[model samples]
Target: MTIADLHTLTGAYAVGALPEREAADFRGHLTRCAACAQEVREFRETAARLALAVAEVPPAALRVRVMAALPEVRQLPPVPAGARGRVVSLRDRRWRHRLPYLAAAACLVAAAVATGVAVEARRDADTQRDRGVVAEQRARVVSALAAAPDAAFHTGALTGGGSATVVSSTRLGAAAILYRDLPPLPGSRVYELWYSRDDVMVPAGLVDTKDPSGSLLLQGHPNGAVGVGVTVEPHGGSDTPSGSPLVVVPL
Candidate 1:
């Protein structure tokens, strides 16, 4: 089905815990999804190693302890009909016949690597150029905020979670807000920042909550805004704040 649906089955697939239908779906997906298949194989190998770590003592009492600690095993899902023929062996003997091509490929790969390095060097240069532009823009905003009056910007504790701060210039009419000490959010939701100039509320950039120590950087100086707010919203956010504000640091 969908990637999210497939993701739900990853743990079960890794542990061979799926039912017939679910397992079959996972297997069918595995054929095309190299990344997921690799993860599953790695997880399976780790589990097998963990199982082997228990001491293999001859005492009959040891069996009771092992069985008691063991988690219930789920049945493997049925292999999809599309998963025909034997699994391809990583160490196929067919490669032996292509040693020459393999060597040629290796040389080509070396050349490609050199070419890649050159490409990356150019990209780095371009990135630096873009960063310079962004830095100039940021400097101008900060300078404007510095000149503005009634601008209060300081980091403070989160209501029940993390901490945030706002820097603004009521005179210059601009603000920059930053937040820290937030937990990661599930993929279903994203945290958003907002600015209120008097009665009208304007959106700030979405906060990145993927990090355990989340940080959000937003730059927007709403006209005639006296208050600011932060809220947890659906991904991509909305024109109006739908969810309750997690943090409200007044400017």
Candidate 2:
């Protein structure tokens, strides 16, 4: 699974919402990604605290909804009949006296797992809310671009000898972008967008156009941008421009 998708499932895995096979897969990821482990620990603690405060029966409709959304849960693989245990080490023998503490730890883990289900439900709602907000923003950007007039088109040349155009509407405070002759970067590097005014450049966003040429929509125009700029940056981009922009289009 992609890293983002795996991150999304951390809450579900903490509460055992995943099938046995999928949970095992996430367990392997937990060993590698410390951030994911930290998230699970935090969410588990929240779940445990909320569980103690609530004793009400869950709505039947909620149960049906959750079950419908979940994938089929897998049963555990059977143990071989002839499998044998290894001889106990001296360390194991010494630890036998701590069985009571071990049992308590197991109970805590089970309780945390139970509370995690409730936490996952809340997370699902938040995720849906976030998605809705993003969808609405994208819709506004599209509408703004579609309504921009021909006189709004502005063009300029890149510092590295390429050309770009920005179709902008100051009234709407948005722009649509297209550029060509700009070479692509290797590996995870790509072009990032910026807006400049009064000689100060502000980041607009990033572009992931893999081909030699492409078009993009610029939403949420910077406060005082009189021009658009594009530069080479690391994959996700930076708060400030890393270097002089390779593409500069006057707006």
Candidate 3:
């Protein structure tokens, strides 16, 4: 999808209204686009306040009246792709993507005010905003791991099969890694990352090795870590190491 199309869905994404595929795509976009992430965060915060401001109950008769009116209403046909731009307001420079957002905003306002959906909507916005922050931070860490002046990298062979490589920057306080040619783990477990300090291992983050190879962002003290290790842990990861290292590299 175009960036503009993704932009139009920012509100929908903030409120969990996008279709599953589009929502997944937008979330992937969120990891790499700080501007979009920040926009989603702001929109979510505003949506939450709107939710809290609209706590009144609608009159009982209103639903009955709306249901009564539906049969007489005529539906408009879908606009053709070529003719869709005919409604543009030539006066506005930002008209390109505003229509969808305006429509989404109007729907949000109506839903929040009329349905009294404040609690659910506010909770979702808060959760989505927090996720945006985490995704954006991971993106920053990955970028720093690649671009920072103090960046360092180490590579080693994995147990059973394959090879692992870690790249990190002490100045940036983050690390990232890529792996190749590894066997997948069992359904009950996945790979998790850890760092070393003071002769002890600290849980740095986790990654899926289900594909047997992929990349992941590992934030927090990658720069200062004395070593890096990967282990097999339960899906949510263990607070402490739960298995012997599949790959270990002393930095």
- Per TM-score, the best of the predicted structures is 1
lDDT, candidate 2, 113-190, per-residue tens: 545666877776676667556545554454344333222556688775667767676556667666666776788987
- Residue-level lDDT of model 3, residues 207-240, one tens digit each, is 7555565566665665556788888899899888
Model 3 lowest lDDT segment of ten: 49-58
Backbone clashes under 3 angstroms, per model: 5, 0, 1
Q: Write the per-residue lDDT of candidate 1 for residues 193-239, one digit (tens) a residue.
A: 78865666689788656643422336565566666787778888888
TM-score of every model?
0.47, 0.41, 0.44
Q: Which ten contiguous residues of candidate 2 have the minimum total lDDT?
A: 47-56
Task: Provide the clash count, candidate 1.
Answer: 5
After superposition, the stretches of candidate 1 with alpha carbons farther than 4 Å from their true spots are: 1-112, 147-150, 197-200, 210-220
Segments of candidate 2 deviating more than 4 angstroms: 1-151
lDDT of all predictions, in order shown?
0.61, 0.65, 0.66
